[model samples]
Target chain A: MDGVLKIFKFELHNLSRSKWVILYAVFYFIITYGLFQFESSQSRVVVSLMNTTLLFIPLVSVVFGTMYLYHSREFIELLLSQPIQRTTIFWGLYMGITIPLSLGFVLGVGIPSVAYGMNKLEDVKVLGGLLTMGVFLTSIFVAFAFLLSIRHDDKMKGLGFSILVWFFFGVLYDALILTGSFVFADYPLEKAMLFLNFLNPIDIARTFLLLQLDISALMGYTGAVFSKFFGGWMGMTTALGVLVMWTLVPLLVALRIFRSKDF
Target chain B: MKSVINILLFSCFVLPLHAGEITVHPGDNLAAAITLAHAGDTILIRKGVYSGVGIVINKPLSLVGTGWPIIDGEGKGEIFTVMSDRVSFEGLEIAHAGLSYIKENAAIKVRDVRYCTIRNNRFRDNFFAIYVSNSHHSVIEDNLIFATVKRNTSTSGNGIHVWKSDSIRIVRNDITGHRDGIYFEFVREALISDNRSEDNLRYGLHFMFSDHCRYVRNTFRGNSSGVAVMYSKYVEMTENVFENNWGPASYGIMLKDINDSHIRGNRFANNTIGIFAEGCSRSMIERNDFADNGWALKIMANCDDNKIFKNNFIGNSFDVSTNSTFSYNTFENNYWSNYTGYDLDRDGIGDVPYRPVRLFSWITEHQPASLFLLRSFFVTVLDLAEAMIPVLTPAKLMDARPSMRRIL
Candidate 1:
């Protein structure tokens, strides 16, 4: 446990200083600040911010997660040579990487939103929903990246899988869901479409944010169903619970593989 | 000849006092006061709470309240039943008319009257405040009317309900919490202006079979479904503000079978749908502001030959959505904030034709379940792909000259 804390802090500092995290934060800051500046309407700005969050957060999280692990291979092995348990090393490295990445995302988006006087009750609710969505999507994608990198021995294969996974969840899964819903358009598909969205973390996150921003547009049959579910307490807890499960299940499998790997 | 001139002068200019002013206090019977007052007489009601039921005015008289007198109906029956021409009711606080399943109990019910005026009164807790039927040249203005909403709309009544009337003017009234602010049926040549109607159970203003009616500079906010202009022709709605009316079946203006209408210079903001035009034809929707609405215009398949131009569509979720792939309406010279085309020729109009209807909006129209993918990147990409290839949406519906800037 002590070895884990030591490695965690050292890796956190190392990754933070690599300038990638700072660069990520500064990039989000500029975009968010610019959006808020140019778009006087609050909801319009939220839509732009949500688009950036949905597209960039997952892409950056997956790539950075895999790239960070591969780059710090020597450091991880040097720690493995010590009198420390493998579980400790895995947890330490996982926490160290996820914490800095999510921190970068939060700090990057939070400051701009708050600075623009987003203090109204409705604005705050929307902002909180979007920020939590970003964090969850980040963790989920990072978890997928860790699992993919852990299984692949070759760097090329690992990087390739990371990109493929990001692309599938970020862009492809929604197309599949749309096609599936269209194919079964004859059947009662409101609940079925809801179920399919639950399978894709990106859809789940987008739905959560979209419900808050585009609610006026969504006052239709499907919008009512989504708002009815997501606006309620039980649905809120369930969506978050599903997101947590998405983060944990992959990381748990990756942990098991790391514990007995021949590296 | 001199004697004839004197007679004419006496008859036309000077006569015995035909109109006398009669004052009534709290304990005085209102029906008796009306009985004593003659035609063209003034009945001045002093400031007091009077409990009266079914008080009938069968002769032409002016009922003026001096100090905002309260006329409590005690929740009994129709309060003031005016059956005479040239009768006026003014500056009175009318409250607590009875509720009935069979009868529409109202504070002031004017039937078969002409040149009637109901103005500067406050109405509260009444089934219907002012119910006018078969009346002409009547004016209802400067009245503050409110009622608590019941469980269902049938139990409540409108603020000012008019039926089978013509040449009516409803002006400068604030009405809320009723079934409808102003309900007009079979009415013609009516003018509704400078009113604030909000928080009604159904519509702020419901017009059915009413032709040649105009509403201008009115604010309809928070109504369940802001307003419905149905089965009407040649109606004009100008400079009205419709806001914050968001619901599944809600819209700023629900145009159903309305033809040859002019909806110009109105501002529709923050509504579920700005204007839902179904089975409507030959209307001109121009110079309006559509901002922050869900579907700025949901023109149905049956709508034809309408002109929509010079409107500024800003911040709307979908600028235009239709149910079918064919459109007969002309959308030209509208300023769409979502227009991304360049004006290569340096004219205010864009070089590219701006398509207001998108593929995703069309998809959601047929399959409403796809709205769950709102703002998804994949859905956006699909919309982009469809935009490049002219497919899925109505190919005929495009603004050939989209203004590069907002139409001020």
Candidate 2:
């Protein structure tokens, strides 16, 4: 535990000192500020932020995470030489990357929105949900980066695979879902839609955005589905659980991979 | 006892000689006074709580209250049953006609009468506030009706309900918490204006089989559903505000099986669907503003020959969603907020026709659960691609002359 903390603290210090992290924060701040300039309504701003963050966060996290691992191969080797536990180093690296990214996001989006002042409780909830979605996307993609790195030893291959995964989630998966819905148009697919959304973190985040931005549109659906998906606590908790699982399952698999990999 | 004897003696002798105003205090026998009073005479009621009067007017009479006297039903029965023509009720707080599934216990029920006037009254906690049935040329105006139901249910009654009536003028009323704010059935030639109906259990204004009606300057907000005009003909709805009527199957105006009507200059906002038209034809829906609704218009496949023009569609989730592959109605000269075409020719109309219906909208209409993919990246790409080349949505549904600015 102490070894993990030490590694985590050191990696965090190093990443915080890096210029890329600062740039990330600045980019997010600009995006959020521009959104506020265009729309004074906090909910609308939050919705736009959800859209931008969903697109950018996954792409940035995956590419950056893979690049960071490949570039720091030597440093990781040096840490491996130490007697520190592999689990400790794994946790340390994970926390180091995730915390800075989340902080950058939270501070960047949070400062402008908090400055705007959330008068409605609903706005505050949506803002919180948006930030949570941002952080979860970061963790999930970073874990995917680890999985890609561990699975592919070559740097170029690892980077290519990272980009491919990002594109697949961003475009192809949703296309397939849309087509699947169309192809199976004759069947009732409400439960299937819910299940499919649970399978993709990006889909889950998009669902979260729609839960607020298009509530009336959602209500235009049948009554039972809306009540089950949005009007009750069960749906929210399930969505949150799926997101947590998306982060955890990847990280755990990456940890298992790290444990047995031969450098 | 002595006062009662003197009143009886006066009623036996003096009442027969002349028809005059009858003044009754709180403790006086209001029923005996009504019996002794002549037709065309006014019963002047003093300020106090009177319950279970069960007053029935069989002749033309006026019940005028001073200082706003209370006529409570005590949750048992209907308050007034006017059976005669030329009857009027004024300046009273009538209340507590309780729930009865059998009899519609209204504060005032004008039945089988003509030329009745129900004005300047406040009604509370009644099953039906003012029920005008089988009447003609009646005027119901300047009244406030409120009920205690938190939401719309069939058990709750309407604020002002008219059935089998004609030439009725319902104006300047504020109603809430009832099943429907105003309801008309089998009525004709009615004018409903300047009413504020909000937070009702059901529709703010619901009419069926009523013809030649004109509704103007009314505000219907936060109801379970908004105004529903159905099976009516030659109706004119102008300058009304339908807002915050949000729920599944809720619409600002649900027009069903109607013909030859004019819906002009209305503002519809924050509704699930601004206009849901089915089996409607020959209607002119013009110069209306639709903002922030789920779907601005859901014109079904069954509708034909309707003209939708000069409307401003702003910030709606979907501009138009229909179950039709072919556009039956004319959509022209509307200003859509999502229109991105350029006007290099400097014409107010866009050089390119704007397609209001998206392929995704059509898809969602076909499969509702697919709406989970709304605003997703892939969906955006699909929409963008579809916009560049129209494939699934109706081809002829495009607005041939899209406005460069809002149609003010």
**Candidate 1: regions farther than 4 A off:** A1-5, A37-40, B1-16
For model 2, what is the error of residue B286's alpha carbon versus the real structure, in angstroms, after optimal superposition?
Answer: 3.0
Prediction RMSDs, each to the true structure: 2.2, 5.4
What lDDT does candidate 2 reach at residue B141?
Answer: 87
Tell me the lDDT of model 1 at A30: 94
Task: Assess candidate 2 and give its lDDT.
Answer: 0.87
Backbone clashes in each candidate structure, one number apiece? 0, 1
lDDT (Cα, 0-100) at B178 in candidate 1 = 91
How would you encode candidate 1's per-residue C-alpha lDDT over B370-394 as one tens digit per residue? 8888888988888888777768888
Worst window of 10 by summed lDDT in candidate 1 chain A: A213-222
**TM-scores, chain B, all models:** 0.97, 0.94
Model 2 residue A91 lDDT?
Answer: 91
Give a tens-digit lDDT track for model 2, residues B1-408: 999999999999987566578998898877678878899889899999887447788888888889998888988888888899999989888998867889888899999989999889999988899999999999998998998755338678989999999999999999999999999999999999999999998899999999999999999999888889899899999999999988886889999998999999999998889999999999999999998788889999899999999999987878998887788899999998778787889889998888888878977877787888888878777787787788888888889899988899
